[model samples]
Target: MAQTSSHVDSEDTVEYWLFPNISEDGDQLQELEAFRTRCFTFIQDQSQNYIWHEDSINLKVVTKRTAGDNPPHLYGKTRYGCNVEDEWFIVHLFRSFSVTENDVVIRIVDSDGDFLLVEAADILPRWANPESCINRVFIHVGQVHMISIADRPSSITPLPSGQPSLMDAVHIVRSMPHLTIAPSPIQEPIRQRIEKCVSQIDSSLHRCNVFVPASVAALLQSYPTLVAPAVHAFCQRDASQLQVIRAMRFFPPETRVWTSVTFTKCLYAMLVHRNYQPDHRTGWTLPPNGDPKRTGSELGMKLAVGFELLANEESLHQQGGDYSLEMDSRWNRFLNTLKEKGFFQDFLESSQPYNELLEKAREFYMNSVGVEGPAKKPVILRLMQSVFADIEKFKKEEAHLPADDDDSWLSVDPATLDQILGDKFGLLGVDDDEAKAEILPKLETFLHRKSDYEGLTPSSGRKKSRKLSHLAPPSASRKTSTLSNTSDVSQLSNHIGFDPDSFASAMQGILDFALPEDNWDLESNSSCLSSYSEEEEGGELVDKEMNNYMQTMDQELLSTDVLRTSVDNPTRKESVMSEGCESFSDVENFQPVKIDSAALESLLASYTMQRGGPGPASILLNQLNLPRSQISASKKQTD
Candidate 1:
């Protein structure tokens, strides 16, 4: 066994051990409250476990809190005080033991009361070497990534003493749980089993699901060699699977998750403990690549590589929740740390491999859209294809960066970004000043509050709010109302790029596309289109009031001819526009215009005699009453 010693501030640094799984899994999820509760309760109830004959030892527990929590007792952590906004748990047990001195040995049992952890400072035989004793406790903690679908956020942490030395194994066996799961003892060395398990689980990384079977659980209890590799695979897999295992903590699905999802939590804890260290003067040095560490921006590049691999699981393809891409709940904490050092841009550039995804996205799109050549594109599909083309172009553009290690993007001017996008991806380029003016304010507001927003950008969220605003009061609705009394319908044609003459010409063309006749749909018709206002239902006689309503509709139809002449002579739009009438109705300036029945009749007679001949119009006129006396009376009123 090899041992190294270091001295710190007048004291010898005897040993530094990492107990990665003392509390709940995740990273260094230190729930001191839970630990204090267990410590106090164990001290109070199990006094005999800690008794060294008559010598009594005392431990005072102070609960440290964080600031983010309002009452300082609620959430993650705070600099000054704490109220935990979220709960995390971890367990770590390490201290020094000297058999040559006044030593105390105690057994700390897990919360379930099934397992006892031995705390031994048993190396002081005077002839015993301290090196071998310390090395015996160096068993690693293995981490499993996924738990189950329900709570995949939690991680699984294997105990620090998962595997032990020959002497250490004997001590562990004596205190081991006498569970009914293992009906037989393992034939191999117990220490070897544990070492194998931890090594396998910590070796690889992934983002796939996991499957834990009952048979494997019983075997894991008897031998520790399976723990490491199994957990490593679980974390790397996509989903989780949990089966009945009498040895492991087995909770029914009715009460809690049957599948284990605490692996990633424990793995993160292990990474932080092994790879990160604090330096008193020059901040700290992250784990450097290629052994002999160099300084400067190289440090940033190495750290970025590690972070990119850690967050490699794409959010787009993750199973379960949309947030499955979140490798750890404290992911932003890691980002904020790097952001402070101005290395976050490098980390983000390393996050997703744009070129790879871009290729696949392009292939998938081409197969789906069914378009052959770009030049033959139809106007109707132009807007839709522009979006598709833009998606591909942007992906390719982002795939290529200004630099590999140096970040030119960090200090780039916003105007430069817009110009670059416009030049390369014209389809996505927004050139409309009016649209930019409408969206820019909301976009900035959202980016300013970036910390609060999740799942989508601020601009998209603001647009949704704007659309929902249509439900408010009248003054809060659309600026121009089509149903308003002052809305003009005549001048609207000009605004729509149409005039009365063009509309009449279009109407003539429509009249040639299979002329409408009474014979059409006569058999299958359920309701008659020719039904008057006094039409009977179930042979019931219509009321006199209904006849009066019919006469009113006829008078309204007479004024429709006033609109007909306006349609026949499109030049009237200029004169009407000259009168200062702008709305759809323009009731003040043009609504009072009366229909000239003589002139309307004359116009209809001329159109009926023209080429395509009034085949159906003559038959339609034969059914109406046009008495000369009524026309004379109308003329007298006009006079």
Candidate 2:
């Protein structure tokens, strides 16, 4: 038989030896014994391939702690100086393979006299060949002794190197369970039910005063949505029941008790839910700022409506019948009276009278037209005169009228007066053709100045131009001229071609003559035409005839004055000659001065008595004092 190595050895070698003579009392000897015992126990428990030799007595010990065992005791001395017997275990078969400084071998003998041989390779497992037995043992034993034998590697293999692919990571991720994200689901049917109820409530609220069941449902649904179910659940009641309870809170105690109804509570709850804050307590004070009495807009609108009614003649007539026009006329006059008396505090205060007058004006409407006609013109005029007379009497008594204060709401506007007059009377003043011709021009001029006295211009591009042509001829041209200027004596004299005193006297006489006589009659009856005369039927007949002649003469004079004094007065035709004066053919020696002087003196004397003047002498003296050149100067100045 060929002799072969009893223990197989290779270039990768492992050694097995025993550490036998450990001193128990030595610092390191105890550690050695523990380590040796642990290794022996591990090797014995391992598979039979790593079994300890049972017959070994002298064991080969190899260690780097010392070159060989020291003191040569049978075993190492104990740390406490106790003697310990050393037992030797021999190697049954020994073989030495290549060894390196990094390789370690551990050998142990237990109390049973069994040998434990452990060979560990020092090379890293990452660099070891899996097929080599030494590397296989090394990989199993591990550089870290704490590693469990169960986890030890049977073999080691080198990892091939290159750029790592991401596919492995992607596959790993894909294999994981998916995590989904989605929006929370809505209870759409519940929302629809709430919306439908709300819509019904809104519709019912617009038409009916009472809240219906649908409204209650809507309110209940909204409450659930707004307040969490956890909070609402505290009541532990159904929505309908809760709504009924809420309605009770809103209803007044009295209403609920008296009417046996709870609608008020429902209304209150709805208002509360909608965030409406109403005065809930009995007798709660209203907001001071919201007081209707203090609101100017409300007062203004009321006054505007009142005036509009007052100004509408047709409306007035409809309301007041045949008397409506006259009633409206009276209403306007009343407003004017109030305005004149300073009852109005400002232009705005005019509305007070306007509002008050509306009640009186209603008689003018068609609804009232069946009523008796108002006493016509003359009666109306007389009534106005009486009213004014009373006012004058009050003034004479020196009684204090109510004065305007800041809070007083009396006011008047010229425009308002114009509207009132235009609506009712068609216009103010006389309607006769000649009287109108005389008054219209003066009135137009007066109105124009009144309308634009402040002279504010329109800011817009389309500005209106003043139409001054309506002014009287003299006023339209005179320097510093006005209607007041028409009263200047010298100017009148120059314009009329008479002495200033004479012209003034003539004007006074004309005005006095124009007044209607108290006793004059519109009827042809002689008794009606004149007061009873004592001369007729004795003194009565003659006196009556004389009175009638005087009355007739007065009427003729008044009619002439009315024609002559007017601006539209027709010119009288002049005779070619007069009984006392020369014909036009004898114009050169006419001697007009003496005649004119005599005529002027007579006229002045008569006018002085009629007009309550100082005397005829005073009139003459005033005329004489006027400078001859002063008249010409005044004319030039006026021009």
Candidate 3:
């Protein structure tokens, strides 16, 4: 017997050799069972009793199973089982190990004729008894081992310990109330493009580049919702950002119109937060009707119109209120000081014209005081009185001069007169007719003769005396002389005890003195006589006459209360000038000579001499000594 080849790819081959007793002699089955029991018992006892035997015996059983059927079975039957049972077992085992449909298990062959049972009883039920029926299949002879058993995974590879599984993560996101489903990862490139655009816009806005428009527009094209907030942020950082948005808006959808209002509001907010107070000086001045731009388009002119309305309302309120006069006065004073410091020119350029503001001020005053009669009277009176007092004080101080008897005269130099006239009255250069007509008479009056005798020159010889006679001109001489005598008497009365007899005697002596002779040829000359006479007699007489006249004028001027009243009320000067013709004696007395030939010549001579030359004075003096006819002819020729 070629030892039945046990390594066959069939379960029948191995099963038939292992247990033959089941089908053999019935009585002998007990002994066979006992032998099998003893074999198992021996292996169990050896495992319990000897540590080394445990491992060796385990190997023994495996060795026995691997060895072909002959030795193992022969030894078991002869030593432990009956002969009859052995023979019968072989045949019956072969029959009992027959392959059946239900028991069809896959068989795998080994090189050593050993087999591994891979059946329903040896593995988990899920694998052995799969819901789907499986037919056993055989594998050909080779060393074989089980690879993967078909089994149900414990909970589908239980979720990771701490982190959410893929499904869990998805489910959690789905369940969230606020979470929005993000665009798919497939759209990542698009999102990246949008992000890049936004970044560019942000960078451009920071750098204050105009490229912000293109960048912002591209971003909004992809993500429209981003427009408003982006604009807001941009504007918050830079007030001028709105300009970019406005430009972009011009492209499409008319975003500019919407942004215009928002931009204006934004500007207003920024200004208000900064406590921006516009200078009233810079307030827009409307043309008489309205600004052309404002008149054309309501929308275009909204800001201008609104500002105007606001300004008007404010003006009305201020006018209607009881404003602080003191505060206004202080502000005016401050403005004046600023003007004095040269800031007024800048202010005028930068601010409103002063005249407009002044008109506004007057309007405000009137409104505050009410429209009723006499409501503004007191303020006007006070203002006028203050001005009058200032004028009077200035006139008194400015008119003050050396007493008439003083040797030095306040004669104005011709150059100084020329400069003053040129600057004040816009005269330039000289015109002979104008000089003689407009200037000479004024000069003569202002120079008023130093002494009466000084007028008696040989050249002016009898003509001057004739003019003196005309002083109390022929028509008025009698009345003038009587008035003059009375005036002298009155003046004498004020200074000395009134003894009519002595006063008469003094007048007689004055009358008796011979008129001084015109002696231009004398050694001292007429000029010398004039000088001495003026010093002794003319000065004393002029001083006395002036004092007396001033006193009498004061008495008469005060008697009517005209001077006091006029001094108290300055508007009277214009009224009196218009209606009454009071001689301007005060003005005439204050007026200085239009030209002082001597003084001018002296100045020019000094200037010339200092520059190493003879002066204009010497030249003029020489010219002056020439005959009057020659002088007149020369003047006519020049003219």
Candidate 4:
């Protein structure tokens, strides 16, 4: 078995496998050779002779869980790992990265233990999540495979010896990738510990014989990790570190146990939010904590883990599987209470607008009176924003990336890859690839296209991808010349030919002569060029001529290329308008009337009144009990 897949710690990283096919690269092959050191050359088992040749290293693995059994296909032997053998290649450690049911996380720790994270893609080769645990694999004589060395008698714990370098082992295992399945079946003691926590909340969550809101039901399917991190270690709960994405709990954050009152409130919220079918009846038992008016990722915080397990052995009873999470009497009795309120797929995304909220609320108000369960697929709110917020809050971010979406089973481990892929009744979200596949049958119909609104945004529409894309990386330094000094100000001097007093007097005289004292006598420099006479034709003719000339100049300014460009630029247009009076510039500065208020109200009232069924006007009249307002204090004073 390989040692832990190493990650740089400043920023914690998840475990994942990289490069499934290792034969093509010569460098990769050489790197693989660097880690191999022959330990056992040959060994013999009952059926056949087992050979561990000089070049090939014996791969080792430990069972993910002692009780959980792997499917026959992934096992290295029929009963090879039932007993321990001296020749071991992989060793299982206490702490290894855990994988979702997919047996894969997109991240991979190569055989070298060099953490390799890849750009996520919708590709043929499926990506696994960051792995924390290396699974037990099948081993045989003269084999190039690995086997599980778990489920050995409790009395034996091997005195592990003669190990390769930890990193070297890691490189070898990852390079030749071992069979990684989920841990062995839940052992008896741990199963007992987990089953003890079962309550109405957990039972309802497990979808045993009771019903829950889509919100609560969805939580049940995913709460096991946080709820029961350890079935056997309740006394040492504080010692174990549990991190779940957006782990919510029952309201009043302090309430760990689920009560009937809490349950009612959760249902009320679904009703208010309109997460029910069109014909269901919403009961009147709404808890203040589950108010529908509330919105955001923190909508239901109390429903998180630290709760009980709702493990129904029936879901775990696979035909060829020997798995069961044992439950006690108290747990079974607690589940009976949930029979009345069935699960419904009425949860709407928090991002929806006011109108959608009203619509959903209308649908959810119906009671579950005769319904079995939610007829439609579960509605999962995409609360990625909330999930990432908590991740950043805890501070493991080396870069900005969304954490993996967790849809693992809440109680019965997770469904196999095939079961998960073929699922049609799951919730909708980034993690619900199977559900998304079912929903999005018209693939090309949803291909993203540029919104017309963006083009009409009246802002610069430069392609941001040009800057962000790797194809046209920005240059370190642009080639351009810098400005040099045109002249030296230190070398320049001022000269005056006359005394200060004389020069001042001369300048005053010049101003007096240059500026006319009379009101309309050659008012502008244009008067000198036009030679307009104020004495003839009442001076109105001169004013008209001046106005006409100014109008023509204004038109010329508007026609200029510079002014046209300024008009095209919103910033330039605003700046020019703010400076002073501009021709038609005030239009841009015009403030719109808040609404077409009076006229709009009148039209709506009239239309509603005419259409019947308490028209918009009648509704207003009904609110006030008067057709119109009368200004009078006489009645008020009498009262």
TM-scores, in order shown?
A: 0.14, 0.11, 0.15, 0.17
The residue-by-residue lDDT of candidate 2 on 220-321, one tens digit each, is 222211111111122233434433333333222221100001111222222223321222442122235676322322221222221222223233344565
Winner of 1 and 2 under TM-score:
1
Local distance difference test, per candidate? Answer: 0.26, 0.26, 0.28, 0.24
For residue 456, what is the lDDT in candidate 3? Answer: 19
Error of 3 at 539 (Å): 26
| Per-residue lDDT of model 4, residues 366-482, tens digit only | 111111122111122221111212322223322332332222332243345324422421212222233222212111111222347522211011221222222111220110000
Question: Evaluated with TM-score, which candidate comes out highest?
Answer: 4
Model 2 TM-score (2 dp): 0.11
Model 3 lDDT on a 0 to 1 scale: 0.28
Off by over 4 Å in 4: 1-224, 227-285, 288-310, 313-475, 478-639
CA error at residue 444 for candidate 4, angstroms: 34
For residue 525, give model 3's deviation from the true position in Å.
Answer: 7.4
The candidate that achieves the highest lDDT relative to the unseen native structure: 3
Name the better of 1 and 3 by lDDT: 3
Per-residue lDDT tens digits for candidate 1, residues 1-639, read: 111121112121112212212222432233432332233233223221211111122222122222221111111110111100000011122111211111111222121111111111111111112332232222221211010011011212221222233233223322332210111111112223334433443232211111222222222223222233233323333322211111122211111101112222233233223332222232223335554222222222222222222222221123323332135434334334334434322433323322222222232222222323321111111111212222233334433422222223335586676456444323242333332232222222333342434223212111324432332323223211211111122232334453333465466566656532322211111122223322566332343344345445545654675545532434333333231113222323323222334443453444234322345332322112212222222322323
